[model samples]
Target: MSALDKALNYSKKVGINECEIVFIKKKTTTARITDSRIVEIKHNFDEDYGIRVIHEKKIASVRTTKPQEIEKTIDLALKSASGVRPRNFWRGLPENIASNQLSGVYDEKLHKISAKETMDIAQIMINSAENSKINTITGSLNIVSENFTIVNSNGLNVEDNATYISGIINAESEQSTIPVSGIGHVSSRTLKSFSPEQIGNEAQIMCTKSINPQKVDSGKYSIIFEPYSVGELLAFVVASNFNFKTFTEKKSCFSNNFQEEIAVNQLNLIDDPHIPEGLGTKSFDDEGIKTQKIKLIENGIFKNTFSNLFDSYKEGKYSTGNAIRIGSPMGRSSEPIPSCAPHNIKINSGDRSQEEMIKNTSNGLLVGRLWYTYAVNPIKGDFSCTARSGIRIIKDGRIIGPGKSVRIIHSLPKMLKNISEIGNDQRNVIQWASLPSITPSIKVEEITVNSI
Candidate 1:
C-alpha cells in the first residue's frame, strides 16, 4: 500500500476522528548567476509527508521526511492535538474530490532536464546581457517538477503533477555618473513559452538606456507602471486586501466597501487558477478542494474575497480553493497546515497599448521596477516604494531621458480610482517567494514623487 493509504488506515485504527496526509515528491534544478557569468548549478530531490489529525474537535499537524516513520508521525500529531484548544466550528475534510488535469501545467522536458541543459539555458541569459557598457550581471534560473498527493480519512484522494520554470537577469552599469541597473524576468509552466533571450535582451536594453540619469524633480506627475512594477504592487500591497479573513476581521481597506465601486470602471481583478502556463495553476488546492476562478473586483466594484477551509468555516462560508503550502524557491510544500492565497492574481487587459498610453501622457514618469514595496498603513490604504531602476521622464508625449531613483508615498484607494489607462501587454510575473500575478502596464494620474 502507498504511504498515504497506510497513514490514513493507521489513523482510523488509532481511533482518530479525522485525518489527512499530504505527500510531496519534488525535483529541482537551479542555476545561479553572478558577475556576468554562471556561478553555480545544482540539483536536488526531496520527499516529504505532512500529516494532520483531529481528535474530538482539536486539530494538530506534523511533518516528516521519513515515510517509514509515518505511524510515529501520526502518534506525535495525536499527542499534540490533546493540548490544543477545541474548534467546535471545524467542519470535516472534503470527501471524493473530483478535478480534471489542467493542460500546460506540466512539461516533460523541464521535468527531466539535465544539468548541462540547465547550464546552457543559463548561458543564454548571460550572453544576452553581455555588453561593453554593462559592468556586471546577476540573477537565477529555477526549474521545478513536483508530484503532490493528498489523502484523508473521509475517502478523499487527489494527486497532481506540476512544472515551473522562471528566469531573471539584472544588468548593472557603471559607465554613467552613478551605478544604474535594469531587470528582466520571465516565468512559465511550459518550456515552449519560456524565453531566455528576451530575459537577457531586455536587461541589456534597459541598462544601456539608463546610462546617464537626470534628476527627477519632486512633484505630482502622471506615472506609468510597467508589468513588473505592477506585479510588485499586486503581490505586496493589493492582494491581502481581498483576503476573506482580513476582510472579515475588518483589517482590509475594502472591508466596508463590499459591492461598492472601489476602482475605475476599466479595472477587473480576478483570482484565476486555470490560465495556461500560470505558475500557480493546478487542478485542486493543497487541501483537495477543487479550484475555481473568483472575481475579486468586477468592473470597479468590490465583489468577493478568497479563503481556505478553516478561515471560511469560521465565518460559515466555503473554501475558494486557495489553500496553499508555498515551498521555498518555488512550488508547493508539505507544510502540514495550509494557508489561503490566490492562484493567480490577474488584471484583465484593457484596449490601450503601452505605446498609446505613453503617447497620451503629457508629462509623466515611466517606472519599470519597484523596490522595498510595502503598505505603510494597510487600514488607511497608504503605501511606500522606491522607483530604483528603468525610470524615464516623459514630456509632451515623448520620453526625454532616464531619471534617477525616487520614492513614492501613495494611497491604494486613491490610486485605484485614478487609474487612467491599463495596457494590453499583459505578462506573467512571479516575485521571489511571493505571489504570482499576470498584469500589464498601468497608468495612474497625479502621483507625487520625492527625489532620493
Candidate 2:
C-alpha cells in the first residue's frame, strides 16, 4: 500500500474520528538576473507531507518533510487535537470526488526542462531588454512542476500534475535626467506561450520612455491604471471583500450591500478556474472539491462569495472549491489545512481599447505600475499606493511626458463607482507570493493624487 493508504488505515486503527493526508512533490528551477546579466541558476527537488487528524470532533494538523514520519505526524496531530476546540458545525470531508483533467495547465517541456535551458531562457530576457539607454536589468525566472495528492477517510483520493513558468525584468536607465526604472512581467503554464522577449522589450520601452519626468500636481484627475497596477489593486485591496468568511463576519466593506449595485454596469468580476494557460487553472481545489467558475460580480451587482469546506460548512453551505495551499515559486503546497482563496480572479474583457481611453481623457495620469499597495482601512475600503514608474501625464487627450512619483489615497467603493472605461487588453498577472489575476487597463475618474 502507498503511504497515504497506510496512513489512513493507521488513523482509523488509532481511533481517530477522521483523517486527511496531503502530499506534494515539487521540482523548481530558478534563474536570477542582475547587472544586465544572468547571475545565478539553482535547482531543487522537495517532498512534503501534511497530516490532519480529527479526534472527538476536534481538528489538528501537522506537516513534515519526511514521508516515513507520517505516522508520527498523525500521532502528533491527534495529541494536539485533544486540547483544541471542536467544530460542531463540521460536516466531515467529502466522499468520492470527481474531477476532469483541465487543459492548458500542464506542459511536458516545462516539466522536464533542464537547468541549462532555463539559463538560456533567462539570457533571452536579458538580451531583449538590452538597450543603449538601459543601464541595468534585474529580475528572475521561475519554473515549477509539482505533483499534488490528497486522500481522506471519506474515500476521497485524487491527484494532479501542474506546471508553471513566470519571468520578470526590471530595466533601469541612468541616461535619463533622473534615474528612472520600468518593469515587465509575464506568466504562463506552457513553455510555448511564455515570452521572455516581450518581458525584456517592455521593460526597456517603459524605462526609456520615462526620461525627465515632469512633476505631477496635487489635484483630482482621471487615471488609467494598466493591467499590472490593476492586478496589484485587486490583490491587495479588492479581492478580500468578497471572501465569505469576511462577509459573514461583517468585516467586508460591502457586507451589507450584497445583491446591490456596487460598481458600474459595465463591470463583471469572476473567479475563473478554467481559463486557458492561466497560472491558477486547476481541476480541483486542494480539499478535493471540483472547481467551478464563480461570478463574484455581474452587471454591477454583487453576486457571490467563495469558500472552502471549513468556511462553507460553518455557514451551512457547500464548498465553492476555492480552498488553496499556496506554494512558494508557484503551485499548490502540502499544507495540512487549506485556506479559502480564489483560483483566478478575472475582470471580464470590455470593448474599449487603452488608446481610446487615453485619448478621451482631458487631464489624467497613465499609471503603469504601483508600489507599496495596501488597504488603509479594509472595512471602509480605503487604500493607498505609490505610483513610482511608467507614469505618463496626459493633457488635452495626449500624453505630453512622463510624470514623477505620486501617492494616491482613495476609497474602493468610490473607485468602483467612478470607473469610466475598461480596456480589452487583458493580461495574466501574478504578484510574488500573492494572488493571480487576469485584468486589463481600468480607467477611473476624479481620483486625487498627492505629489511625492
Residue pairs whose backbone atoms clash in candidate 2: none
Model 1 global lDDT (CA atoms, 0 to 1): 0.94
lDDT of model number 2:
0.93
lDDT of 2 by residue, 134-240 (tens): 99999999999999999999999999999999999999998877899999999999999999999998899889899899999999999999999999999999999
Error of 2 at 326 (Å): 0.4
Off by over 4 Å in 2: none
Question: Which structure among the candidates has the greatest lDDT?
Answer: 1
Clashes of 2: 0
TM-score of decoy 1: 0.99
RMSD of 2: 0.8
